[model samples]
Target: MSPPKTYLITGTTSGMGLALVKHLLSQSQNVIATGRDIVSRFPREIVAAHEENLRLLELDITADVDTLQEIAREAWGLFPGGVDVLFNNAGMSAVKACEEASEEYIQQIYTVNLFGPMRLTTAFLPLLRQKTTTTTASSTVIAFTSSSAAWTPLPFMAHYASSKAALSAYLESLAKEVNPPPFRISVVGFECGGCVTNLGQPRQHKQQQQPQSGGSGGLLAKQQEEKTVYGDGLGKLVGMFTRDAMAYMPGDADKMARAMVGVIERVGKQGGGKVPVRLVLGSDAWESVKQKVEETQQVLEEWKEVSWGTDREGVRGGAEGDYLRAVSIL
Candidate 1:
């Protein structure tokens, strides 16, 4: 049998990151997992148990650029041979309204969700390139954990959504720039639906209270409040979100790990083909993507006649179109 492919994943201490790590390890695949609080969050015995396939690295992706670069260098040194996949799964979400959200909160969210992943991907590209060079048949992939919020606007989460939007845009440009011969870059925008993850916890806001798990009735009440205030028809969305946040999603970490592994395997067999630029992970995300696309299409269609002119000169160049051009210029 061939050797197992190696993966390097960030934010492995909790939520999707932790789930991905557990899943990868169970497959007997090699994984280098990084997180801000690995030592504190994971039990020593549990970590030690996967010694053969797991390497825990402490990295706060939201750290200063220089510090993050240093961490990347250290990680590169640790995996001297290079990694097959660099999964940028570490991120944070802000629950406060944009106006109420502090600058610090906004900056922190952007740093973790956008800048950190971009820097890490830049640092690791050389190694991934090297792997592709040596093993002519293999390919390297860079995956990002984006959100459905990137597609649809969410009240009280504008900062989080904007940061993800920036990341998505950057990855789209980066994919175009990195196109070359046998070496290829695949960016998976994992637009996750509400999973049972720690994302719902309002960590960035100062006044928000911690979530409590009480009796079934209390949980039901909380769900009701979330729906009434947040939006209606959110039952399924909330269920998935609760499951992800609570670590109760079907098969929990295993399911996520297997899904990721399957994606990588499929990418590999396609002759180093790229993973879809977008991977809407759950049903909620699919609906959101569909709705957003349809809305955009509708808006464009409604204004098509006004947007399109009979001729280029008629639209902007001639004196007859100077007013239109001037308005357009603004």
Candidate 2:
């Protein structure tokens, strides 16, 4: 067993976030769980039983940066020893065709999925950095629940996937900026596969109090019916999901949470050494990424000449050339 570490997780009202909170508490780790209406969202009995190890705060990640900074400051105060892990796990999605997706809705998704996490991480950086200089200093990690949907092609998930892709890219750039020897912070993105979570439900379905899984079918159908042009294609897509919605996202949330903890523990145990930039959580996610990589490699191979031809004829030994050569891009 590793030493008990403090974890601050966003979006703990339900699904993977809630499961992570419970699993960490079970392991005797301190958890600061945040979400909107957490008192109603989390089981009261569990909260009472783990009062010493758990703290709940109401947070809507879409809030302004100043508000997020305030909450981050408050969270830092809750655990003065400093956080060992900051889990940016809160996310939301809407199920609608790109053509029909409103600008407001699109902006909302970006705010929640991309901008919110970025701002929150900025807010907590000082706190995370504080842990490194303390007498009881230890490795600190910034973890994200980036989705495999970032690279996979799933209809009506374009905006969600785009947001996650941006998040992943941002995290990659952040890892480069931090994680050097003295900084002692590690950034990891989990390209999580589908699990039986409420994420698939469109916002409207949640408003109507429908089942989380398979709830998007009716909404998707209604949208397509009005368009008519997308009728046949949407019908097949809806039919597939209606027949086996679970097939698309079959991983158990509890199990996924456990695996995530295991990974975090391993990274922490490394004593702030190098860790993977991203980890694929489930078999479905692994396969999706694998396929995407292979196809990309094939494309690159086919376009190798054209890609390399774009460079200037006289360009050879400059800084950019040297760096590209070092990485074998030349």
Q: For each candidate in the order shown, give its overall lDDT on alpha carbons.
A: 0.64, 0.75
Model 1 Cα lDDT, one tens digit per residue, 7-83: 88887766677677777777777888887666666557757888877787887676666776667667666654557
Distance from true location, Cα of 309 in model 1, Å? 4.5
Against the hidden true structure, what lDDT does model 1 obtain?
Answer: 0.64
Residue runs of model 1 more than 4 Å from their true location after superposition: 134-137, 202-254, 270-274, 309-330
Per-residue lDDT tens digits of candidate 2, residues 53-126? 88888777777889988998888778647678999997876666788788988997888789989999998987
TM-score of each: 0.77, 0.88
lDDT for residue 62 in candidate 1, whole number 0-100: 61
Report the lDDT of model 1 for residue 300.
85
